[model samples]
Every structure is written in C-alpha cells, then in structure tokens.
Target chain A: MYSRDEFFLLIEDLSLLPAISPSCRSAFDKMEDPEASLIGIGHLIEEDPGLASRLIKVANSPFYPYSGKVGSVREALVRLGLETTRGVILTTSLFDRIRGEAGVYALWQHSLAVSMISRNIAGHLRMPYPDEVALAGLLHDIGKIPYFMHDASEMHRSISDVDPGRPDYKREKEAFGMDHMEIGEHLTISWRFPSIVCAPIRWHHNPAKSPEADRTVVRIVALGDLIASAYGLGHPEFPFVDGDILQLTEELNLLGAEVTSLLTDFLYDRDLIVQRSHDVF
Target chain B: MARMMKVELATTEDGEMIVQDVHDMLGRLLVRAPRRIDPELKRMLLARGIQEVFIPDQSSGDAEYERQIVEQERDAIRKRFSRLQDTPDNKRIVEIFIRAFEVFHAEKGKIPPV
Candidate 1:
C-alpha cells in the first residue's frame, strides 16, 4: 500500500487530473471576497458565455422561488446568492472538465439523485442554504473520478469490484490506502473549497465524526445517500447497508415520529425528485 | 366521521377541511391539516403550483388508499432488498419506506410508476 504522500505524488506524476482552471479559480476567489460587487461577479461570469447561460438556467430552475424570468447573469447571481452561485460554478466547472470520461454518466446520475434528495431533506427540515447542500451532494463522491481515469485493469480490480457485505470505502481503502472520503477531502482542500462543501464530502459516511457546526448537513447527506442507494439509484459497488438508515436517524436526533414524518415526505416526492435529477446535466 | 380523500387542489370544494398537512413537490409544508379549505389557501397552493391535497370525503373509505399504495410497492422493495440480512433494522427500513409511501400517497395524489 502506498503512503499518503506517495498517493499524492502518484496523482501528480501520472497527471491523474488537472487543477481547477485559472480563470474559474480567479472568479471563485473574487466571489468570496467581501469587496466584490454583484456587477463585478457578473462581469467575471459573463466572460465565459457557456457558464453564464448555465447560471441562468440554474437560477430559473424551480429550486429558487423567483417567479420572473431571469434574463441576465447579474440578475441570476443575485437570485442564486453568492454562496450558492459559487457552489454552482465550482460543481459545473468540475463536471464540464470531467465530461466524456468513461463511466462518468452513471456516476453523474447517482450524484444527481443524492443531490436532489439531499436538497429535499434540507428544505423539509427548513435548513439554510438548501442549494449549497445540493452542490455538496453532487460533488461528494468526486474522489472516485481519478480511479475512473486510472489504467483500465487497475480500475476494474479496485473500484469496479463488488464487495457485497462491506461498505464501498473499506474496499477502496484496502486497494488504494485511502478511502474515497479522504481522497475527496484532499481534492477539495487543494481546490480551496469552503468547509460547508468539503465537510460532507469527507464525513458523510461517518457523520458523527464531523464537527458540531456541520453535523446536521453531513447527516442529511448520509441519509440522502442511503435513500438513493435503497431506491436503486446508488453506486453499484459501495451501497450503504441496511442498518445505516437507522444509525443516521439516531445521529440526527430525530425521534421516531419525526423520522416517520420526514420519511413520508421523502417517499411522497421520491419520483418527482428523481425525475428532476435527470435534468441536471 | 367521513373518510379522507385526495383531490386536485383546483377542484377542492368549499367547506372541505384538510385531513392532513399539505406539502409542495419538494416536501416543504404548506399548511398544517385539520384546517378549513379557504380561498386564500387555494390561492397560495395555486401560486406555488401545487396540484393536490387531502380533504375529508363522505364517499370512499380511508383504508383503501393506504392499502393500495403499500400493495403496489411492498413486494418490489422486498425483492430489491432480498440480499440484505434479515435483521430488525432492515425489516423496519422496508416497512418505513413502504408505509411512508402509503401515507404520502394517501395524503397527496399518488404518482403511478413510469
């Protein structure tokens, strides 16, 4: 097994993936700056016509409450808010960069399911930043992308193996000396993602280990992941097992009645949400 | 004393008290139940593009909706999860998933499988 430092070296030496584009990274940094204006952020996003159009579509989606049609990037930026707009730009840019890689479509579909479910749970609980949670879910499993890009024989022997009784991460840890969560955490940190986005990526599988401030959102992602897997929208090899649902509810401190109510809402909207997930890409 | 019935929001009649909470497509609560169906509530639901809500009905019985929803999904879920160990947690999960599916469909209109 390779040491953690060696893993990083291998990733860099083999060119497993490229860093975030300089232009997108600069725009993201500007959005984070307190001195940045809405017009200024708009101008930066407008420089790339493709991103600008995608931002408008995301703004007009039913996720946001604005009734009027969004015509301009500036207006879309205002509608999405800075944090959520930043999340959108980051996720979409990453998704764009990884497009056409083998097995990316299935992976995207699973992420979309988790993203939609997580957002629904966030809204049902009246949590803040539901859209940001959606983006977090979308990017949670992104550490697996490098495996997909690795040599075909290695990818098949490691990631594609179906370990029926164990969690997916344990197998990944055995094979690569790091689980997907750890890999994901490292990648997001290198990309300079905020804690809100990175915490779920790292802690979703074991939410109790997350900091108190981020525990609830991490629990939401865990539940969303379980539910998605239960409904056959899960990752083929690493699906969360049966007891995970109960464990997560306990971690969230949800009483039996509350769990029942929350799950009823999830069941009610499952099909509609699943249908909407397909529209993401 | 009457059974609850799921009705399209646009067609709900006057004086029909909602028997359960009304939620939108995303599962956010709109109005808590045991409340009267007012024009204002209807307007709000319409504004939000909601299509249905559970209202008290004199014609059909309450048991049918729950039974139907559970029956439609129970076997399929059990088959899908057959590989899981037959523990209490797994059984409860299957039950909760199917039961919640029943409750939600009984409250709101059901979406048939595609």
Candidate 2:
C-alpha cells in the first residue's frame, strides 16, 4: 500500500505530476488577483487559440443565458464571471493534461454531471459563490486521477472490488493507505486552489465533517454527487451510500417537498444535461 | 409496446428495436427500422453522428406495464442505495428517487400523468 508520505512526495515534486501549461498557470494567477481585469485574462487565454475557442464555446453553451452572443474570449470571460471562469479553466486544463488515459473520459463525464447538478442546485438555493460550488463538484473526484495515472488496470480493479457497504474511498484507503479525498485535498491545496473550492473535494463523502464555514456548500456538493449517481450518470461500477435526506434538507433550509420539486425539474432536464456534457467534452 | 418514444440513442439498451429508419445528411440509408440495436449497431449509429432515435416505448401501456417500469426503476434506485441500512430516513430518500422517476416518465408521456 502507498503511504501518505509517498502521496505528498508525488504532489510536492512538480516534475513528477501532470504539468499545467505555463500560460494556463499564469492565467490562473491573474484570475485570483483582485486587481486583474477581464481584458488581461482574455489576452492571456488568447495565447492558446484552442483554449480561447473552448472558452468561447463554453460561453455559448446552454448553461449561460447569453448563448450565441459571446463573440470573443474577453466576452466569454466576462460572461462566465471570474469564479466560473476559474472553474472552467481549471477543469478543462487538468482534464486535458490526461485526456486519453484509461477511465479519464468517463471520469470527466461524471464530473460534468456533478458540476452541472451542483450549479443548478446552487442556483435554486441562491447560495453564495455558486460558481465555486460548481468548481468543487467538477474537481471532487480528482483524487482518483493519480491512481489511474499510476496503473490504469489496477485502479479499475480497486474501484470495482469495493464492497457495497463501503464508500469507494474506504477501498482506496485499504489499497493506498490514503483515500481520494485526502489526496485531492493535498493536490488542490498544492495547486493553490482556494479553500472554498478544495473543501468539497476533501469532504464530499462526509459533509458533516467539513469545516463550519464551508459545511453548507460542502453539503450541497455532496447532495449533487449523490443525485448524479442516482440518475445513472456515475461510473457504472461505483455504488453510493444513502444520504440522510431529512438532515440534508433541514440543514439546507429546504423542505423535503422543495427538494422533490427541484429533483423533478432535474429529471425533466436530464436529457438537456446529457447533451450539454456531450457538447462540452 | 404501444407508443413510440423519442429517446437518447446512447441510453438505448441492447435488443431494443428501432421504430424508424435512420438516414445520413446525404439521404443515404444507414439503418432500417424494426431493427434491434445491439452494442455494435449503437456504435455505428453514434459514429455516424446520430444522437437521438425513435424507439417503441416499451414502458408505455396498461397498468401492468407501468407497474413493471416502476418496479425496474425502483430496483435500480434501491441498488444505488443498497449500502445504507434499512432505516426510516433511507426509505424516505429512496422513495424520493422513485417518485421523481415516476414523475419524469409521466411528464414525458410514457405513462399516465401523475
């Protein structure tokens, strides 16, 4: 089994980890700066034509109300907002680095579903930093990426062999001496992601254990992940533990009937969600 | 099967029969209707850029058909939540999933409206 030190060593050694392009890294830095303007970020994105076009396409995606009107990278960045653009860039950049590796594509699909669900749930709840919540959902499963990178076949077996009663992370713990959530927390923090975005990745499986400041959004992401799995949008091999719906709803300041209504809406729009994922990926 | 339903081609299961002929933009016949879509056939269709298809709605019919679909959907939901103990809270949560699925099917005209 891999030790926690090895995991940290892998993350700390920048040369050993997947490389985020310098331009992407620079853009990320500018995004985090309070004084940076949209034009500055747009110019940085334009350094990579492919990335710029992708941003434009995402701006026109069905997720935004301004579809077909975003004509440039600047406009896309402006329309997507700073928080969401950070998410889009981070998600796209990280996934792109390992695009063809085994299980990566399916993982990306599941992430997209969770991201969309989280965004919609946040919108419905009028939560602060809906974009950050969406970012959290998109990167929640990132802990698994390193394992797949190490040994694709072994990772597949580890995930498949999980007992029904235990979460996938517990199985990972047995195999690696550390769970995906722990790995994800370290990786995201090492990459300089904000605490709000890293909180869900660290505690999505057990939101109650998250810090009090981030517990609400963490719970939102956890619910989104569960709902996505229930909708058959998750990896086919993974099973989920039951979420305490009563506790979650009460904590979120929502009634059970309200959640039902929200779910009904999601069900009605599931096809659209699938199409959106297909388009983005 | 009583009525034809528009379904996402990716979600179509093996052995489900297509209800219409699929043609390319060039008007060339790609696949004929009344054909069962196996894994290979689904791949070929998807490779040709077909994302949606008309299929005989197996879930549309009398009370028995609705009951069967509900059972299947519930079974799927239950399996997703199989890890949880049989507690009142878990039961309510599973019920929510089942109810939302039924509502989706009903709204899509695959069954009687709720």
TM-score of each: 0.70, 0.80
Residue-wise lDDT of candidate 1 within A1-281, one digit each (tens)?
44556566655542322545665666787977889899988888888877788889888865454699999999998888887787667666666655554335556666776777788778777887887787788788877765544433455465445445666677667766677798787777766677888899999888888988888889889888877766545654443344378878776677677776876655644555445644545
Q: How well is candidate 2 docked (DockQ)?
A: 0.27
Model 1 CA deviation exceeding 4 Å by range: A1-3, A10-19, A63-67, A150-153, A156-159, A239-243, A255-257, A267-269, A273-278, B1-76, B79-85, B104-114
Where is model 2 more than 4 Å wrong at Cα? A14-18, A65-68, B1-71
Q: What lDDT is reached at residue A276 by model 2?
A: 64
Query: Alpha carbon lDDT of residue A108, candidate 2?
Result: 71
Score candidate 2 by TM-score against the native.
0.80
* Clashing residue pairs in candidate 1 (N, C-alpha, C atoms within 3 angstroms): none
lDDT for A61 in candidate 2 is 81
Q: Which candidate is the best by DockQ?
A: 2
The per-model DockQ list reads 0.12, 0.27
**Each prediction's RMSD to truth:** 13.8, 5.9
Clashing pairs in 2: none
Candidate 1 TM-score, true structure as reference: 0.70
Candidate 2 structure quality by residue, lDDT tens digits, A42-101? 999899888888888888987554546888999898788877786777677767766655
Report the poorest 10 consecutive residues by lDDT, candidate 2 chain A: A10-19
